[model samples]
Target: MKIANQISMKEIAKLCDVSVATVSRVINNNGRFSEETRKKVLDTIEKYQYNTNTVAKALRMKKSNTIGIIVPDISNEFFSTIVHGVESFFFEKGFSTIICNTGKSKEKEKVYLKTLDSKMVDGLICISGQEEIEASLLSRNIPIVTMDRRPKMTNNLAIIESDHSQGGYLATKHLIEKGCKNIIILTKKNRLSPDIDRMEGYKEALTEYGIPFTLQSIVETTDHPKGNFEAAREAIRQELESGRTFDGVFATNDWIALGVVKALSDFGKKVPDDVKVVGFDDITIVKYIETPLTTIRHDVEKLAEVTSKLFYQLLTEKDVLIKQKHIKIPVELIARKTT
Candidate 1:
C-alpha cells in the first residue's frame, strides 16, 4: 500500500477492502470484528506505518492515561521508595507516570504543578513541602492524592501519611526507657505539618514522664545536608561546652540522626551506652551505618500504593470516592544497635 504524509482511516479501509466503519471499529477494538478481518486491518496499519493521534483520542475520551507525581526530593530514599510503589501500581494498569522533584522549594513545586497540568495529566500525587499551596490546588478541582503531608485548607483532598506523631512518641519513649533522662529533639523550625506533629509527640512523651520541656533543647536547622550537619555538630559542641549532659537524642529524620551519630562518635561517645539515639523514616543508609540506627519506620511503599489506588478509584469510580479524606498508615519502630 502506498503511504502519504498523512494517512487516513479511508486509505487503511481501502487497503483492507472494508468500510471505514469497519476500520474504525478495528482501530478502537470497539464493536466486534472477526479475527481474520482484524488481522488484515492491523496488517495494513503496520504496512502504512499508521499512528493514531493520541491527543485527539484523549480529547474524545476526556481522559489521558497519564498521572503526575510530585515529591520533595527524588534522591531521598523515602521518596524514592514511595515513587517505586506508585510507578509499579500505575504501570500495571496501563498508565504512565510523570515524576517531578520539587527540591523542597515552593516555586519549583508551583512550576512543576503547572507544567504537569499543561501536559493534561489525569491526576496528581503531591508530597507537598508548603502547606499554603493547598488552596491553589483545591481551586483547580484536579483530583490530588497527597503523601507524607496533608493540606491545611481542604477536607476534600485525599491524604496518605504515616502516623508521625506516634512515631515520634515511640522513638522518644524508647530512648527514655534505656535510662536516658536528659533528652533533646533535633528538628527543623518550620511549621510543616509533619514536623509540627512530630514535635507535639516528642513533647507529649516528655510531659508524660514529668520531664521539663525547654525551648533551648530544640535545635532547629535548615533542612539541607550541610545545615543539618552543622546544626548537629554545633548543638553537641555547645552542650559539651556548657557542661550540659544529654543521654538521649531524637533527630526528626534519619539524615539528621546519621549526622548526630557522626558528631557523637567524633566526640568519643558510644551509642546506646553513653547516649542513645533514635531517628525517623528508617532510610536505608541507617541500617548499614557504623552504629546500625534504631529508627521509626514509615511504610513509604504502602503509602504510595494506597495513594495510587485512591487516585485510580477517584478517576474511575467517581461517586464512590466522595467520602475519602485522610488515610493514616501505621509506623513501626525498628530496633538496631544504636539504641
Candidate 2:
C-alpha cells in the first residue's frame, strides 16, 4: 500500500534496507552506490512520496549545499572558464554556486569572503589571484580548493593548477627549435605563481641552449581594466624605440601576443620570416587570429574537474585531508603559424 504521508531519509533508508547515505547518494545522483540499491531506494521513495526539503535538510545537517567561487576577473576567458567548470560540477551534485568577481582588488576579495562566510557557504573555490586569502578562511572546517593560487595557509585542502613551468619551457624550447635566438619575454608584472613558473621554465630553456638570460630581454605590462592589449602594444613599442633587438618573443598569454604582433607590424617586422613568436594559453581566438598562435594550452576543464572531485572527496570523507595535495594538470604546446 502506498503511504499517504511524506517520510524522512531515515524512513526511506530503513525501508530499502540500506544506510541513509546510500539513500542520499541515490537522491543526489552523487557518490557511489550499487544499481540494485538505487532501484530499491527509488522504489521505496516513490511508494512513500518522500519530499526533499532542501532547507530543512540543510538545517539539520548544518550543510547549506552551497559553494562560493572567488575569481580576479569574470570577464577574463581563463577565469570565466574555471568558474563555469566549477559551477557546472557542483550544480550536477545538487549544489548552488556564488561567484565573486574581485576585479583584482584585495578589498573586494575580503568583502566577498565575509559575505560568503555570512551566507554559510559549504565550500570555497579560489582562482588565480594576486592577493593572499586570510588564514582564518583557510582554517575553517570546510574544504577550500584553490586553482593556480596559493593560500597563506600551507595546509589548505587542495591546490590544482596547470604546469606553467613546463608550459613556459616548452614555449621557449619550441621557439629555440624554430631557429630563433635572442628571444624576449612579453609578460604581465603580477609575479603570480603562473607568471613566476613560466619565467622559470623560460630561463631553464635559455640556460640549456647556452643562451644568457638578461634583464633587457624582459618586457612587462599591466592588465588594464579594459584589456592587456594596449599596454602590451605600448610596452613593445617602447622596447623597440630603446633599440632592443630580439629574434623571438614568448608572450605569457595570447592576448598579449596579439598586442606584440601588432606592435611588430607597426615596426614593419615580418613574423616567422624575421621574428618568431610563441605564446601561452591557446585560447579559441588564437587559432583564428591573423597569425595563428604557437602557444601552451592550459586545461581549464580538467583543472576544474580535478579540483571539484578533490573537494567532494574531502567534504564526504573527513579524513581524506590527512595530507595536503598540490596537483598540477599537464599542459600541451600547440604549434601554429606564429612559429
Candidate 3:
C-alpha cells in the first residue's frame, strides 16, 4: 500500500502525539527536547520515512541558489583560475555554480547564455570574446557581469578587467631597457580592446624609446594554440630567410609566448641570451617550463570575486542604479629565466 509514501511530517507528528513545532525542532536539531520526546520523534520519523522538500524551500526563497559562469575555454589555466575564484566565493554564500565553456565561438556563447537563462540561474558571469549581443538584451531583466572581455557597445554592463595597456607598456619597456633594439610583436587580427590597447602601448613604448617602428614586424595570426605555434615558427623562419635580426619578441598571451619559446629553441636561438621574450597572462605552465617565462600577471581571482559581488548586489538590492562601471585591476611583470 506504499505506507511510507503515504506518510509525512504531519503524520509523524500525529503518530508521536506531539505538536508540529516539537516534531520540527527535534527533526532539525534546533531546540532542546526531553529524551523521551526526542526518542518518540525519531521513531515516528523513521517509521514514516519522511523527507523534507528542499525544492519547495528554494522556491519559497525565489532563488535557485545557483550562479552560471560562461567562459571562453576551460582547458586554459587562466580561465580555470578564474573559475576557482568564482566557486570559492559562491560556495561560501551557500550557492552552487555551473560552468560552460564556449570555445570562443559567438554562436556557442549565445546558445549557452540562452540555455542558462532558461535554467533560471540567479545571476550570470560571462567572459565573452565577441561584442554582438545587444546591451539592451543584457540590461533588460537579469543581472549580468562581464569578466576579462568587455562588451563593445554597452556602458550599462559591469566589467572587470586587467590593465592590458599597462601590461604591454611594462613588457615592451622592460625589453627596451634590456637593450633590445629590433623588437617584434605577434598578436591576433581585429583583437578585443585589451589586445588593441596593449598593441598601442607597445607602439608607444617603442616610440618613446626612439626605436624605429616597422609594420613588417607585426605578425597577425588566427587565435589558437596550434595557429600561434605555426605563426611563431613561420615568423622566425622568415626573419632568418630575410637575413634580419630581432632582439626581442612580445606575444599577446602566454600560450603564444610558449609557442614562440618553442620556435626559438627549434631555431637554435636562446631566450634572454639571443632574444628576450615577454608574454601576457602568466599561465601556470609558464612557470614550470625549461625557461621560466617573463610575463604579465593579472589578478584573475580578484576579477571573479568582484564580478560575483556585483551580480549579487544587482540581484539583492532594490533600486540599485546600474552604471557603466569599468573596474581596472592592476598588472605586474614577473621577471623569470626568459628575461
- Model 3 C-alpha lDDT per residue in residues 1-339, reported as the tens digit of each score: 347757767877888898888877665444577878877877665555635333323323446777788888887787788788888888988888889898888878878776665455677777755755544333125566787676665433577888888898999999998889888888877687788878987998999999888898787765445666676666666666777778898888887788778877877988989999999998888899889999999987677777778777776786588564778888999999888
Candidate 2 Cα deviation (angstroms), residue 97: 1.2
What are the lDDT figures for the candidates, one per model?
A: 0.78, 0.81, 0.76
Q: In order, what is each prediction's RMSD in angstroms?
A: 8.4, 9.9, 10.3
Task: Please say which candidate is ahead in TM-score: 2 or 3.
Answer: 2
Find the candidate with the highest lDDT and give its number.
Answer: 2
Off by over 4 Å in 2: 1-60, 137-139, 223-226, 322-324
Candidate 1 C-alpha lDDT tens digits along 230-291: 76666666676777778999998887787788778878888879989998888877888778
| Ranking of all predicted structures according to TM-score, beginning with the best and ending with the worst | 2, 1, 3
Residue 4, candidate 2: Cα error in Å is 27
Q: In candidate 1, how many clashes are counted?
A: 0
TM-scores of the candidates in the order shown = 0.80, 0.80, 0.76
Q: What is candidate 1's CA lDDT for residue 208?
A: 93
Model 2: ten consecutive residues of lowest lDDT: 51-60
Tens digits of per-residue lDDT, candidate 2, 131-199, equal: 477646432467778888876676545788999999999999999999988899989887788888999
